[model samples]
Target: MPLRFPIRPEGLTSGPTLRPSGGPNGAPTYEMWKRRIGASLARRDEWKESVIRFFVELRGERVITWGAEEMQQYFDFWVNILYSNAKILLGHIYFQDPKLIVKKTTDRVIELAPMIEALAQYYQRELKIKRTNQKALINGIITNLGVTKTGYKAIFGEPIEAVDERDEDSIAVTERSLRQMGLLKDEKKGVLDPEKYHELIADERPFVINVSPFDMLFPVGSKEMDELQWVGQEITTFLSTVKNNPLYPKELTENLQGTHIVEMPEGRRMLGIDRDAFAGDEEYKIIRIYEIYDMKNNQFHIIEPTVRDFLHSSANPYEVLDGHPYDFFQPCISPGKDVYGTPLPKIDEAVRLEYVTIRQRIMAHIDKFVARLAVRSDGLDEATLRQAKQGDLGSIIITTDDPNKVFSGMPNPGIDPATFIHLNQLLNDLRISTGISEAKRSGEGRRKTKGEAVLIEKGSDVALSVDQDKVDDFVTGQARRLVQVILRFVDYPIALMFADPGQAEQERAVIPSEDIRAEVHFSVKVGSSQQPNPELDRILKTDLFSLAINPATREALGFQGKAPDYVRMFEDVVAAHNLPNPEDYLVDLPPPEQELEEGEEGGQEPANILQALAGGQQ
Candidate 1:
């Protein structure tokens, strides 16, 4: 009675026919014998060897794609037979579902990320989710959330009833998550808006930075450069045009010729030089002027701003370039501006290697500097850096987080809560009541104890033009708030003068305790080879992975070969009830979701079309 799909209809007979023996069509006895032999094999060993496979991806044990779970499981089992541990190493790549809208796809994936994360951990060591993954996750959640809703509740029941529904609220989280997945194309606004900040996440590989070596050295100066800064700004614009920004042109010129850039009223004195020009100098008077830029030893090929400036106009830059293109002009490790507009010296191979070596030393020290900031000593667990406020300086970390939502977010500029109103009332009273106020003879407070120092309302003092009356009013008002006290006589006591003052405020500098450490990783070049330097390569493969670094260490040693295009600051995590930095308060409204359109077109109701179709059918 066992069922098999591939069997022919005629062969399922009581006794299979070899050729219908004795019937109009064939010989029954021989047919029966051969059919019995065929059926008796059950299945050939070779047939059993080739097994069919099925896989299952369950969301809380509810199948997202119907029958996919069984297929996945079967495939995993068969694959294992051919190769051991195949399931444990598999990774999945999700794409946008052909049937789902881009918005819906994003919403679904974010919802399912936690679920997918658990599954990835169970089946494989790695996990990933593409924008496309959203659709699949959404579909899975829809399928799972529906069927297992009751079961999941029962399993996680009783004392958990008070939990709030975080997932259902904040529908804008879908759009934010989509953007993180690299799918949303809304170009009008920057992505940092807090309503858009509620959702985000990722996975990664590799580490590198642009800190170049010492041979391609640039001189350091304390003063900030004006022209250099401007040139840097222009160069940054130029680099933006070059997709990945590939050059590092330091302001290096071997033999320099600099024409002074004009600034108004030249500090160096010239008896009668033209407005735009200055002749020589008594220049040793220290006018704070400086040449803030210089080139790496042999890095530039100083040529005319035009083609005529080259040493040999017709020669190739490579043949005339001293070293290979990559080394002659290695990408700049540190950002700089050309201090002198003159042609730079061409660098050779020897210099490039040395440059890499010394730059590595500078980078190494930076690592030590960052380590100094992280608080680690003895066996005490590391605590969050609780920075203390100092002087007029406040302790606030720059963040993208929504302030209104924060526990200590600044008081709302829009609404005055009761505490703030009460504080404001107290402050106004202090501002008006200075010393004594007898003028306030009919207000809420007017009485004072017998020897209380009170400033009475007196008319303006002549000649001096001082508002003695107003001053008296303020002073007398203040006396009502103060306790009456007698002071020992002074040489020139102007009848009951008040003198005790409040304590002076202490002051301090800001050196705050930072939870995050600045870090640097060393990168060295072995001459000009395409191969990774053996020392650096070894560090990446061995040191980076094996080292059990804390979060601060990971942040510090982010990369040495490259810098980040977008650095997500730890302080930037935030959320809001509405899109954009709300000009007013955030009202907790329902999230943005697409609702059922009731037979719509372009998301509007489509009643006419339905009516027309019905009429046509009739």
Candidate 2:
């Protein structure tokens, strides 16, 4: 039976009753949330399927359905331009080392910048953020949307077993040992070892996870994620995993049943899971867990609707940025006005279909042009015709007096070169539509001069800058969320490397929980992750060297023509070229007063700037 909603006389419609006609309830039953999730999924099933198809096309898999077998065979040749285009796009967006800039709003938190930036670097390293961003960018390019969930995770170590006080020998030894290790807080109040009692033995840190668009769900008609009433994530895991997870109740997990929904096959197939493998296996059953965050009610829930059970429910545990921990990246701007606007994919459906059509036509043309034999049966005998048809080498054909009538080669039609020209034009169109130029894709430009090539590269960069800006915004948002997690949940002090200005080596610094202030701003350095332009590097080097070598230019630029100034300029040139270990080439120059004293004592000449520059260059 189809579900129906209630329509009022005023011409307004309300969804079906969440609870049964007359069921007692403190909160909406698991069935109600399940239905809500179902409605949200129903609203976006078609859209999600389209995104999935885009991914399928990106993988170079066949997506054409209801086609003739012969035609399908001919269409087997997929030019797979999408794959190459996506690869080039990903390379341009993937950041090697993301430079996160931090600023504090209040003067009181001014000292926290170094610690916070260091912590950001720590999270980037531990979480493998560069790799994560690459994955998200790939998904974003394919589906037009990318998502990341950020939160703090605290993992505690194994607990120490309780020792009975009646066994004085055992109690005494345990208490004394714990006291020596500084784990004991009280002896008489039954709380002997605080570490064992509090279960604070393990690591706690922030985490970021790349979320698939299919796994995420928002309320119907939600234009923006922030304005949504609720959001949910569908997690599929083994039954044992849920049972062993400390967050979910073990009793509920043990009694819960695995999901057997027929509607989930598409999603499962996309994730590369075989449905039949664990269908009826009780021990290895797969559980579908829905983690829903109710922003309006400030509640979080973990439920297994297959069993109609709520495994866990509570107020929002993470009160970080926006009181939720999700950041979204859309590579292309949505064409619609709504927040849930349909994003324009880099390799859209129309482009893929057109490419396949053109390539298949070219294939068909070639197939039709293949040489075939045609002989006159009236002039040639059946055996001779068969032998001629076989066309075997060294087999002489005994033909009639009019050999031309008996055997003749069929005239083959020439394939028009225009067909290939059209195909090439189609390929160029694909690149242009995706904002990828031939030079960017091939990593070479047609320009003869370096300046012209640089100009072309710059033009390509401008075309891709929009997507790059979106990625930067996504990363900046995630960084802010991580900082919030650090401020609110990081209880212990962590040691991290702090990059001090004017210092050759990074210094180790420890940041305690109190030092992480909540009021801070975050942003990524624009284009910090982009591939370096050799022309720009050359220009910078030229300018710096000219300044170092020309005394007049330095004096004009307010640089005191001195040995130390020349050394600084040389270091700047090395840095501009991205050469490692600037310190290795530098010499420890004496202070001017010391140099003067030495000159007076030994009547030595002042340090020569030109020699110092030359030696450093060598």
Best-matching candidate per lDDT:
2
Model 2 vs truth, CA RMSD: 14.0
Against the reference, the lDDT scores of all candidates come to 0.24, 0.61
Clashing pairs for model 2 are: none
TM-score of each: 0.12, 0.62
Cα RMSD, each candidate: 47.5, 14.0
lDDT of 1 by residue, 462-541 (tens): 21122222222222221111111000000111111121234232222111122111111111111211112233333333
Off by over 4 Å in 2: 1-29, 55-83, 160-198, 245-251, 259-283, 336-348, 370-426, 491-518, 526-618
List candidate 1 segments past 4 Å from native: 1-197, 201-618
Give the TM-score (vs. native) of candidate 1. 0.12
